[model samples]
Target: MSQIPLEHILLLSAVLFCLGLLAVITKRHAVVVLMGVELIFNAANLNLVAFSRYDPSLLQGQLFSLFVIVVAAAEAAVALAIVLRVYQHFKTANLNEIATIDK
Candidate 1:
């Protein structure tokens, strides 16, 4: 049986990262942007896990990936709180419309 190559995982992660960046740039909704950020985080996680699998001697990547997951969870909590506050203040979740707080 042929083993899957590490390059395949890296390529998949890269594609996901690019898509997430595009979503963050082009989406107008705050929630959509948040989702893009989550996607990017997951891409980094996939890369870490893939690297860990390819090279068993390096456990740091997996440990760092765990830390990343924790950080991502905390970020999501804070971001959701902010989004809720924005919705409460503006009565809308559109990123463009939430600029009223800029003053």
Candidate 2:
């Protein structure tokens, strides 16, 4: 079986990153923003794995990707906890309203 080209993988990663960024910027819900951040992390992971395929010996890219995954998981847990607390305090998950309340 022929391997997929790196360029195609990178292109897909770029698309994922852009879509994630758009969601993070345009969506109002805290959960949606978290999902967007996940998408961005996934895009980076994809790129890392794709590049790792080229030099199988070192495995640096794959290792780094694993580290990133771990960090992302921790980040998600902490962020969700913060969001939950914010929701409890504010009674709403809309980021705009949250920001307004801060002032």
Candidate 3:
């Protein structure tokens, strides 16, 4: 069986990172921004897995990736909760509108 190239894997990771950055920068909705952050995390995870494939130990990369996944899940939950509260308090999820918190 032919194995995939490391360069290709890194390229995919780069693409994912860029897309996530674009989403975070261009989107105004809090949920969309959260999704973007998740994308970035996924990209990092992919890189970790890919690099782990080349390592002799083989376990370190996968273990780190698993840890990252757990942290990301927790972060997403807390972030969504915060977003929900913000929406409840402000009646809008747009980040720009939420900036005017003095009202």
Cα shift from native, residue 102, model 3 (Å): 2.0
Candidate 3 collision pairs: none
Candidate 3, superposed: residue stretches over 4 Å from native: 101-103
Q: Which lDDT tens digits does candidate 1 get at residues 1-103? A: 8767999989999999999999999998999999999999999999999888878888988998999999999999999999999899788999877775576
- Residue range 1-103, candidate 3, lDDT tens digits: 9979999999999999999999999999999999999999999999999999998676888999999999999999999999999999999999999997766
Per-candidate RMSD vs. true structure? 1.6, 0.9, 1.1
Q: Give Cα-based local distance difference scores for all models.
A: 0.92, 0.96, 0.95
Write out the backbone clash pairs for model 1: none
TM-scores across all candidates? 0.91, 0.95, 0.95
Candidate 2 local lDDT, residue 77: 99
Clash count, predicted structure 2: 0
Which scores greater on lDDT, model 1 or model 3? 3
Best by lDDT: 2
C-alpha lDDT of residue 47 in model 2: 95
What RMSD value applies to candidate 3? 1.1
